[model samples]
Target: MRAVILGGIARRVLDELLRNPYRTIELRSARNVLAVEKAMDEALKLFLTYDPIEDVSTGTEGLLADLIEAKQLEMRVPWEESDEREITVCRAKVKLFGLGRVVEVERRERILVAKVRELFPHEMNMG
Candidate 1:
């Protein structure tokens, strides 16, 4: 359950980060980044070995839904201007801020997409 929530948070964070474009956002949380990274790895692994389940969706979709239902994921990012922001999130703890370097949005998208893709790609009717 933690992994699932972390996956939802990671996707939420990255998606929010990318949408801002040309801004430096500090993602702070009580949950360490290792949990988020582990979630990503596990998500990728699931995509790699997913068994088709009729009328159901797999991968991050379910995670996202749960995050939405649980209200653990913030849909709107807080905007900061002229100064760096320090936010204390209640969901999880994290000391590692992955966006410290401030990469381009395109590159960030590529990195995220690559990270989420299955190790072995195959057509699955997860529904």
Candidate 2:
């Protein structure tokens, strides 16, 4: 299942997004587009490999969605900006084996950071 997803469905999805010239306004500059492409690929890899799910979930889409959002947010940073702009990519709760887990992925200065933590069953009951 994982192989099928990464090799087929996910691959097609990534390819489509990469090929879409109008995907985002931030890709105007070739330099920025290349940077974003690299980041997008990284985001997909992180999503597919993290936890190794047999089927797709919102988490998968969320990571990509958040990455795009991060890029949009990054554009507002002035060219002269020096400080790192930390953007929240994904912070979602996913159920595995009926247990809830939190998936957090963030972007800072074109770098992607991701982490997953198994939630205590009781944690799932909270807000």
Candidate 3:
């Protein structure tokens, strides 16, 4: 299938690029780029094996696998600014799924903060 061909090539390219550090100069300072690319490559490879109808479904399933790991960490630990940081960090892992956009994450965090404030108005005193 088309996806299988494309995905196979992409995976090969990614593997070669990763194996050759010289190719990652663009990502020298931003290691997250590598992580994002790797995830995308994986999603593409997985997409290749499924029919068009199953593509979206399988992609979402793979994406959720990443998200569930993040959620587990979020629940297991005490909430702190660092926890927020962890969420942001974990979000990068799902970027390849095309569903975890930065704007969406920001909006979600803002909504969560607002809800928490409403539930505990006095928890943080502006004064």
Candidate 4:
């Protein structure tokens, strides 16, 4: 069986907000879409480094679904009060076993930050 650890980008954004509340509006702006896209791309790159999935395999699809589900769950149980202007970002950290012992990381984002590692998973020490 495989194991998955889930987390959201909202947490990281929230932390940033706590440190600099003024950026909240800017973070949600449409202009930040590229940043968010880059973040997702980076996340995918990180995932593939450990677990490379091909076109036909359902692994990528399933992993994406799991990541989205995890994000939804995280939203349902917010660590702080929900705000209308606040956006939640979610992602997953997946572990595959058996013949393919690999780890995958996925991330969702609402804003583009120059240095955001909130959704990135730590290096796995286990094999």
Quick one: best lDDT, which candidate?
A: 2
What clash count does candidate 1 reach?
Answer: 9
Candidate 1, pairs of clashing residues: 29-93, 29-94, 30-92, 30-93, 31-92, 31-93, 31-94, 32-93, 56-127
Error of 1 at 1 (Å): 23
- Cα RMSD (Å) per model? 15.1, 13.9, 19.9, 14.8
Query: lDDT tens string, model 3, 1-127?
Result: 1111111113343334334422211121122233334435444211111112212222211111121111112323346634443332222221122111011111221111000111122332211
- Ten-residue region with minimum lDDT total, candidate 2: 1-10
What tens digits encode model 1's per-residue C-alpha lDDT throughout 53-120?
Answer: 22122243321111111113333344654253444432432222222111111122112211232212
Candidate 2 RMSD to the correct structure: 13.9
Ranking by TM-score: 1, 2, 4, 3
Clashing pairs in 3: none
| Number of the top-ranking candidate, with TM-score as the measure | 1
What is the TM-score of candidate 4?
0.18
What does the lDDT read for residue 94 in candidate 1?
27
Output the worst ten-in-a-row residue range by lDDT, candidate 4.
61-70
C-alpha lDDT of all candidate models, in order? 0.27, 0.32, 0.22, 0.27
TM-score of each: 0.20, 0.19, 0.15, 0.18
Clashes of each: 9, 0, 0, 1
The all-Cα superposition gives candidate 1 an RMSD in Å to the true structure of 15.1
